[model samples]
Structures are given as structure tokens and as C-alpha cells.
Target: MSERATPVKPTEEQEREQSRETERPSDGGADAAGPGPNADGATATEPVTTGAEAVVRALENAGVEYAFGVQGGAIMPVYDALFDSEIYHVTMAHEQGAAHAADAYGVVAGDPGVCLATSGPGATNLVTGIADADMDSDPVLALTGQVPTAFVGNDAFQETDTTGVTTPITKDNTFSSDPDRVGSDVSEAFALAREGRPGPTLVDLPKDVTNAVTDREPDEPRVPDTYHVQEEADPEIVEAAARRIEEAKKPAMLLGGGVIKGNASDVCREFAIEHEIPVITTMPGIGSFSEDHELSLEMAGMHGTGYANMAITHCDTLIAIGTRFDDRLTGGIETFAPDAEVIHVDIDPAEISKNIHADYPLVGDAATVVEQLREAVETSPKAKKWRAQCQQWKSDYSMAYEVPEDEPVQPQFVVEALDEATSDRAVVTTGVGQHQMWACQYWTFTEPRTWVSSHGLGTMGYGLPAAIGARLAADDDQEVVCIDGDGSFLMTIQELSVAVREDLDITVAVLNNEYIGMVRQWQDAFFEGRHSASDYHWMPEFDKLAEAFGAKGFRIDDYDEVADTIEAALAYDGPSVIDVHIDPQANVYPMVPSGGDNGQFALTEDQL
Candidate 1:
């Protein structure tokens, strides 16, 4: 894989320079040249600039150093401009990779990630990733080049309504056929993506717009404050929610990814402590509640900690903050916490009661709403019984199944070894599968924003690229680990090159079970124990592949060596792969078969 010439490692002085550049006057005109008259009586025959230059210049002004995309016929001009400029462009094997990488980059960098593709199929391929960003409230700017304006809507070669296709999923979208509107439209798209309650946005640029000459002086785009959501909390609604909290016997806080997104964990913790309530988080919300906190119930729903699930099952009142109660967190929605009266708070109005019912729908920012709720709940006495019950549940169901032998080969053992070796400090990204579940179950995330995985999107091959993006975003001297399964690793295993060339300290921890673990588990529990197509018949020696990439590699068959190997991998200065072989029969327990309700979960091998 060819690498970019200049990696984005800015010094402190460079940071200061970038900051000053942001504050500098926004003159969009390309340094006074081209068709304009010169001070002397000489005619300048320089090439005329176009709207595409202005759009690209705005990206540079925003400190966008990289763009991910797969170039197509309609997008060739934009790609040409990008290559000619100082911005780095990464070619992706699949547009999904581009979109996901961009999404991860945004999450890690706290800015809008840029992605580009052409019309029709190329643009369609990015739909899933765009939707992922939309659902997660991630900041991503997706640009798709359209067919010539005159040829649009006639089913011209490679033409599709990219904006129309993305409008439902994107926070905002625009289509620009006029050459003059490209810069402002693209600037608006990027600004909208990074504003309050950030999300993905799209700008469809016609081919003619890219090639058309613009003699008019480019105006630096203005960023309006309208993109941010207003914080307007109704005192009456806050009091009603508080009164419900005050009157309840068993109240538990269901923390979602939204809490982290809104940076409302402090407020959440304040409310929890003030009201003496326990917290149960969703998979994406794993780190929102501190694991060290006495009142924290790590996770809730299918594959969640047993204590977390039971707390949700038994709680009398549920205060859901910054969460939409997705199916994974609810098991089956119909039977989830039938006794609890739900109080939902979110910035988006449509999310209040979309899936699960909310007894109190207070639409506002999580931080503001939670602060108000905290103020109202300042007088509630501590509920000793409720906290004690939650603690008992945590003590009972939260324990990990013991790896019986000194040479035991359990996924839990591998994850535990990695956790112990790493001290749970690094940002861990996981591919979607049984390994992902195991990481969620056994790996303790002590800090917020340290765990990244495909929770809602559930996309395979997310771990490696996500880890790569994370390391890039860290921009510091810190290690990142990609916990992957065999099936998921094979999806985009080519990303190993990215880690090697960039020399990122990323360890690929492959929990090799010789099977697609999740589907196999499903088959064993519900499909009458028939394995069918779930088995991975054969796999390459991953260690050899890692060595081929000019990186260190290790294969651990004995569980006793797991801890030492993980530590060694961490000590390595560059990327390394640790393939840990484990039992194929091992499956994450407390499984609720698809379509089954909460009580329908299988607890032990006897139930299986």
C-alpha cells in the first residue's frame, strides 16, 4: 500500500499556527492571479479557477488534512484537485471502509471526517456507513459527484439522486448543479455535520459544476450558530420527572451512548448520586458509568452483564438518559421492564418514544435536562434498599465464569489476560461477532471514550480500521488494540498494511475459534444444534501473514501464555498480531434467542 507523503503529526507551534489560521480573515479568493488584471500592462494567461477549488480550499481552512474515498468517472476532477493540493487522499477497497474510517476519524478527532464518491453505485455503497454515523450522531461530511446537470434525471450513465438517498439518514443534505453554489453548499454541509448534536451530511456536486470556470471572487463561507440545537428545558417537565424519581421505590438509570455524546456523564453521575439510584448502560454506553463507582451496573440488555440485565428487569422506574432504547438493549421490547415507568431525555424530538414507550418525554440536551433533574431531585432521601438490591445483583450475576485449568483455553480467559496485561488503559476496538460480545462481557473499560465497536451498525471488519483511525486520532504516544474474531478479521484483513506503514502501536488480538461464533451460537441454541454453514473450514496462518507485513506476530495455543504474550505485544514498538486459539464450543452465555423476550434468555449449558 502506498502511503501519504506527510502524516498528520502537528507540533505545538504548528497547533498555534493552525489556531491563528482559523482566526485569520476568510478571503476565499485564490491568491490574486489567473484572469484578473495585473498592476503592469501585461496580460496574464493563467488557467481560470473553478468552484471546486473554493470548496477544497474551505476544507483546507477547516484543517482537514485527509479525505477518504474511491474515485469514479464523475469524481475524477475532484480527485485530481485533491491530489494536486496538499491534502492527503486515501483510496479504499470499499466505500463502506471509506465511510467507516471517516466516521471513526471524526469520533476520534472531534471534527467532521470527509468522504467522497461518485454517483449511483459508488454513492449507494456509502449508504450503510452514512446511516451508521447518523444513528450514532457522529460528524461526517459525505460528498458525491453527480452527473452533468443537463443529463440528470434521465438515467444518464452513473447518475443517482445522492442527496435524496441520504436525506432521511443525514442531518442535512444539499444538491448543487450551479457552479457558483458549490463552495457555500459544501461549507454548510461540513458546518452542519460538526454543529450541536452532530451527524452526517451530504453534498451532491454535478460534473459540470466541477469543470465550470468561475471569474467571480470567492467569498469565505460563514458558519451560522443555527446548526446547534437550543437548550430549552421546561421546568414543569423536569419537576414531573423528578417527582416520578422521588416517588419510585426501585429506580435505575439507563445510560446510553447519547450521554457520552452529549458529554453529560458528570450531570448523570450527579443525578444518580443525589437520587441514590443505580445505573445500567447499553453496549454503546459501556464506559459512560465508571466501573469503579459503587452504583454502576456496567451494561444492560442481551449479552450484557447479568447484574445489569436483572437490574433493568426488576427496576420499578427507569430514567433513560440520552438513549433511544434500541432492541439490543431491550431484549424484546414488549417484555422489557414491564413494571418500570420510563422517563426519556434526548436532544432529538423524534427519538422520545419512537421504539419503546416513554411515560415522560422531555426533549432537550442531556446535559441541560439532567442538570435540571438533578436540581429537582436534591431533596430525595437516599434509598438504601434499592442500592443494596442492585449491589447484590451485581455481586451475583456479574462474576465471570472461571477458567478451570492452568492451561485453560476460554475466550474469557484470553480477554481477561489482555485486560490484565494492558491494565485496561488502551482504546479497544472490536469486530462484530462473538469476540465483540466477549469483549463487552469480560473486558473492563474503566474510562469513558476508550471502547469503540460496531454496536448499532454491527458491521464486520470494523475493528482494524477503527483501531487505525483511533491511533491516528490519538496523535499521542499511546497503544491501541483491535480485538477481532477469525471471521471478522478476514473481512478487511488488508488493513494490516495501514498499521504497519503508519507504525501505529496496534495489537491485533484474534480470538480464533475456527468458526463464525455468533451464528454458530445461534444455530446451536435455535437451529436444533445443526452447524450448517457457520463453520470456518480452514484459515491461513495469521502469524505468517503478519510477519509478511513486516510486523511481529505470535500464536498462543496455551492459555497460560496469554498474559505474557499480550504484555510482549504491548511492549513492541510497532504493530503486532497475537492469535489466541480457544475452544470452538465456547459461547457467550445468558443468551436470549432472537425474537425471544427477556425471561427467555438461556443461562447455562443445561438450558442450552
Candidate 2:
């Protein structure tokens, strides 16, 4: 079994039958290809199986070690086939959890993650995760079971047009009608998910198709011949961009998620260091650059570091790699990097000038294009004074929060304490909210794939499920930590049961403020302090809740309890939750309003 596969034991009867078959069977069949006489029959020259078995074989051929999903009627055929296969299936608490888990697995493992679900609500439940992957460019392959082809358009029980619903979100989608072609459809979907600009793909497997018998085997996963990605940018354009960088008095390098996805972190890091340029990353690009380095400006955006924003405001040359320039990162495009000439590098041609206009667009693989620039550059930029200025800005606006003796526990304190306790390589996952920002700001990321979270879609219940995926993908030495908020945790907390069942070692720290913290903060800043529906006063005690789910639970109410609770929770063998009650009034600092200039950020509401 693969290391990632956790074998689910078979029943006594099933084991006995398997032993009997092993003891009696000795007729090995010769390798050949032909239509099967029957589902179970095999010839000396040909081996025959059902379509469902072929699906499992295709996954095995593709080296799939793990899969995440739920059991259902339409998908029962595939699940039954999986029972005999070596692939390990993580039965998630919900289909949505399954989708997010697969997504995070892809993010961490650098391979396309697989998920499965049945028609109707099960298929619908996966929509959010699919959309999340679509927006963030995470590679995920979703397999959804549909009603039998005969019943597909008849509105039969549990019937759903899954392909129709997911077409807009997936990079490609297929509805399998022929048993002979079903396995290939799945392979194609899996291939398309990780090709070029990575994104989600889906294959709708109808019950009849999966149930039908077939001898045809799926080919190795491959995209159509027509599909192509430009691995190397135009050599002339790379030369021009290098010239701009060499001539720049104030130059900065911006790394995005693509730097990590395309496996270009090392080259990008080397290029930046060789040229002595300050590096800034967007939220999704957190781990692409080492924040511990002197040239690092951390993340740049609405809640980015003050110095990072300042560098963008005044830099004469901005070499942005792998980012789509989301509005959150490029606040008020008219004001963002106004003085700089932009050199944008992205694998997708559509993203080059889609948002912020790229003065020098270099469209190709991130690593390849960066290597091109590295070879083409003749002289490094002279930005000694500019680098010093960024250092000074870092000192001027430090990421410090006051945890007074008389005040409630600060969320920042909890974040830092957790970071201090875990190794630097520990994988961090989060849901959308104040806690997410705190994790992004306080936790120092120095490695790619170390940071996993819902970025583009901002899904609330992403943390715990993501932890499950990251834990499976991560090495045994690396710890999985989830920094979630009360609201976000509550959304997907049910997955805690799955973690406990699997005996996964992960610690979830819920920055419990008894409110939809980010929404309440926004209400405070933008809505005249009206609480409205943002308050979450009736929240459950997450520490006690974890215990109810048969896992260790700890709570922190005072500064004295913070360290001990986190230690105790991390020490526990299985899933653990530290419900650290944070100060309700605390808010994310260095804030920028929608479309505001990145340079003019407020440290507090009064400043706003």
C-alpha cells in the first residue's frame, strides 16, 4: 500500500472468500485486448471487468494513492469497485468537506486531488469547493455520479445535471454515456485539471455507464493534442524585461501562487537574491518567498505589511510573477504601483492584461520564464538606498499587538504562540475570517505549499477539512495546524469526527470571539458600528464540542492559559481543539478600504 493509503480492514466473510480464491486460483491469463464474454469471465489472452472496475484501474494506473468522498446510490458502483483496489478512500463527513480536502491535498502534494459524490444534493454540495479551486487555480478532479442515462433527463430520484451546473467552474467537464469511454473520460478530466493554468475539472458518471460491463481499459491520463502551454516566453520579451530590471533605480519582485504551483520557488528566490531586489508576495503567494530574509517584504495588499505596500507605491520597476492581480491585492488599480512599470509573468495568456495592464507581458511557465530572465540579464539593478528604505519601513510599522495584563486574550498572541510551538515547516490551513488574517500575518512561512487556505472564494468552513488533506500529503515530521475563527470553525466542524475516526494528528486553534469577527469588524468600520447579523453570541463551546466528538479539547481564557492549552492540545495524539477566547474588539491592523491605495493604510479605525 502507498504510505498515504490507510487500509480499511475487510470483514471476516470477505477475508475468507479472498483466502479461498487465492488458495484455489492458479490460471494466469495472457495479456491481450478484446470485448469481454462476461463481467467476471477472463480468457487466457484477455482479462475482462465491469466499467466500475475499469474506473478503479484507471486511477491505479495514474498512481492515485488516496481519494476523498461520500457513499451514495448512484456512486455505489464505483465505491464497490474501490473496495478491492489499493487506493485509500477518506469518507468525509460531507461532500463539501470531501471537495475541500481534495483541493488542499492537491495544493500540498503538487498533484491533482480526486473527490467523488453522487447526484443532486451531493453534487450540489461540491459546487463551493469546485468554485474555490477554480478561483484559486488549485488542481482538483471531481467525479460525480448521475442518474442512469435512461433516467437522466426524466427527473428521476436523485437525478441532477451535474455537468450543466459545474461547466462554468471547471476547466473542463464531461458526461459519460458509454461504458467503454467512461474511464477515459475520467482520465481526461484528471489530466485537464493539472494542465497549463491548473484548475478544477469534473466527469459526470451516470449509473448505467458505471454499471455496464466492458473490457476496454483507460489510457494514461492525457490532454487533447490541441491543448498546449507555452513553456518559454518570447526570448526578445524576456531580454526587454531584463533590461528594465537592470536599469531600475527602485525595483521589487512580486511572487504569486503560480511561483509555487509551477515549482519555480527556488529559481525565483535565487533570481531575487542575485539581483538584490526586495520580494513581495500576494496572500495566495505567502510561502513562495522566505519572510525571514532581509529582502522579503512579506505579503502586499489590503492587509499587507506597511513596508511591502510602501515598496509597491514607489518602486520604478515591478516584476510580478504568477499573480492575476486580484482586486484585494491591487487596491485602486489607478493608484497601485502607479509610478512603476509592470512586468507580469503568467502561464495563461488571458490573465496577462485582464486586470492591471502589464507593461511588459511575459506569458509562459513561471519557472521557465524566470530562468529565461536569469540567463538574459546582463547587470543587476542598483537599489541599495531603496532596499534600506524598505528595511526602515519594516521597523517603523512592526506587527506588534498589546496583550495587556488587564485585557482579554489577544488573538495575535495565540497565533504567535502556536507558530513558536510548531516547526517552521508545519503546514497551516485556515478558513476565511479574522483568524485567517492573523495566521497569514503572524505565522512566518518560508516554504512553498506550507500555507493552504480558501483564497479567491473565501470559503468559511475550509480549515478542518483542509487539515485532513494536508496531514495526509505532509511528511510524518511536519505538523498540521488549523487557525480558524468561531464562525468559520462552526461551518465545517463536523469534519472533526472524520479526523478522530482516522486518528489524524492535527491541532485546531479556534480564535473564539463569540462573533462573526470579520463581519463585525467590517460593520464597525464601514456600517456605522451596526452589529446587525454579524454577532455570533450563541456559539457553542468548541473545546467541549471537540470532546463530544471523541477528541481532546482545551480552552484558553487568560494569558496564563494560552501557552499551556496550546501545548496540551498539540501533545494530544489525535485531533484536538484549542478554543482560545480572543478579545472581541480586536481587529486586523494595517487596513485598506476597497479600492483604496495600498500605500495609504490605517493601523486603527481612528486612522481610517
- Pick the lDDT winner: 2
Which candidate number maximizes TM-score? 2
Report the lDDT tens digits of candidate 2 across residue range 1-608: 11221222223546434432432122121101122232455432243267787777778677676788988999889887776554567889999999999999999989889999999989999999999999999999998888988897888999878999999998999998989988888888888899899999998888888999998988789998999999999988898999999999999999999999999999999999999999999999999999999999999898999999999999999999999999999899999999999999999999998988898999999999999999999899989999999999999988887879899989998899999999989999999989999999999999999999999899999999999988878876788999999999999999999888777888999999998998899999989999999889999999899999998998899999888888888887778998889899999988888899999999999888
Q: Write the per-residue lDDT of candidate 1 for residues 127-198, one digit (tens) a residue.
A: 988998887788899989889989988999998888888989998888877667677677778888876677
TM-score for each candidate, following the candidate numbering: 0.88, 0.93
Residue 447 in model 1: shift from native, Å? 2.4
Alpha-carbon lDDT, every model:
0.76, 0.88
Stretches of candidate 1 off by over 4 Å are 1-48, 84-87, 153-157, 215-230, 406-408, 423-425
Off by over 4 Å in 2: 1-48
Enumerate clash totals for all models, in the order shown. Answer: 0, 0
What are the RMSD figures for all models against the true structure? 5.7, 5.7
Clashing pairs in 2: none
